[model samples]
Target: MTRCDWAENADEVMTHYHDYEWGVPTKDERETFELMTLEMMQAGLSWQTILNKRQNFKAAFADFKVDQVALFDDADVDRLMHDAGIIRNRLKIKDTVYNAQQLVKWHAAGKTMNAYLWAFVDGRPVVNRYQTASEVPAQTALSQQVSKALKKAGFKFMGPTIVQSWLEALGILDDHLAKCTVNHLGKK
Candidate 1:
């Protein structure tokens, strides 16, 4: 089957991610938080690198449990910094904790990250019919709004470009190529 060019002839890990998870809408809280953190961690890095080290990240950050990560202190930060299995960016590590704290605060206020984010698209995915990678934009007006909202909500390391990629990764914005066999992802 013809897949998106990004995954065509790609590594096994990236191919699996594209075929199974990319552009697939999900409401699982842990998964959402995990992907958000992954996107944050992916700043200035290759997606392949992140995918390769996903398991390490999942283990290092308590399986991306927001509350568990929110409890991470300087000690955990130091440990993560020394971890060669994952990215050793101190600011990103600290920001992950801080972002989790923000998410916890929002949850306490009766708002979930899933609900807040899905609301942006009126609870539906926005499918795009781009024919080539070049047709896909790095950022959009909607992403700008989301990025600004996230920053105001005390989330760090999430700017428009990152948010755009995250949105696509979350399937809130389906940017599959027109001819991709998995363009309309549905749990496959």
Candidate 2:
């Protein structure tokens, strides 16, 4: 039951995420968008903090349904700001809506979020063999490319570092430590 060093000492929420969700490939567009939004919200926070508030986020953002969140107006923003269960960062909240809008547009244009995102990795995960936490990177060249493309597409709060973490979480970039049990979970 060995996990990544980062999650080894985490609380139940983080431990479960590490064991069952992190690095597990998902083609579902809504789930991918949800994880991407969470990573953006986690820019200056710990993953545990984001995980703890995930349910609140789902509820606040209409379970991260892109079409629904894309329709959120100023009133929705205000409500989210007053919500105690989720992070009340105004910029992050607004950007969540903006990102949803972009996702919806992509979907309408016959380019699903899943296809647009996975295209960066040629529709497969990039598995890395890091022996320790230190060996893992905060960002990579591929992440920079993806971030640049996303920013150009009107996605806010998605810097290279944030995109890298999102990719790892979505299994586009599998960064499980070599000794971790989930190290072999993603594509080779």
Candidate 3:
């Protein structure tokens, strides 16, 4: 079973992520928030590093529960800063809190992350048929639009590149390689 090029030579954790969870779509808000937070934390780091620390991130960030994370205050930020288990970047940690707050606001407005995001793609995932690893793009115009929209909505650490990765991680953009076996896994 050939995997996506990026995951083919990866470690066990990444291999598992690629094989099982990478592009599986979910409407569950907590899972969506978790994936988005992980992408935000991965800005300057490798995805493998983030994956290795995922459990720690979950623990530190209230298990990716947006409501719980939205309630994070200075004391919580300080605790996260001191936590060695997660990435511990002050800006990223703060942004995670801010993002949760924004999501909470969105929720109060009777909106959901899944509804807000999937709407951009007309309520369906965009399955790309790239032929090789090199053909995969880091960002797209749609990503830029989403980035701008998210920033306007008070989210931080969510530029186009990060947003694109988040979208892919959320299975909104199915980027599995055309020939990779997992390519069709998401379409189902």
lDDT score, candidate 3, position 186: 43
Model 2 CA deviation exceeding 4 Å by range = 183-188
Query: Candidate 2's error at 51, in angstroms?
Result: 0.7
Residue by residue across 1-188, what tens digits does model 2's lDDT show? 88999898988999888888888888988889899889988989988889999999999989989999999999999999999999899999999999898888888888887888898888998999799999899999999999999899888999999999999988898899988875445532
Q: Assess candidate 2 and give its TM-score to the true structure.
A: 0.95
Most lDDT-accurate candidate? 1
> Lowest summed lDDT over 10 consecutive residues: which window, candidate 3?
179-188
Higher-TM-score candidate of 1 and 2: 1
lDDT of 1 by residue, 9-65 (tens): 899999989988888898888888999999999999999999999999999999999
Which model is ahead, 1 or 3, in terms of TM-score? 1
Query: Candidates 1 and 3: which is better by lDDT?
Result: 1
Clashing pairs in 2: none
Where is model 3 more than 4 Å wrong at Cα? 183-188
RMSD of each: 1.1, 2.0, 1.6
Model 3 lDDT, residue 84, Cα: 92
lDDT of 3 by residue, 1-188 (tens): 88999999989999888877777776789999999899988998999999999999989988999999999999999999999999888999999999999999989999999998999999888988799989888999989999999888888998999999988888888899887786445443
Candidate 2: residue 154 lDDT (0-100): 84
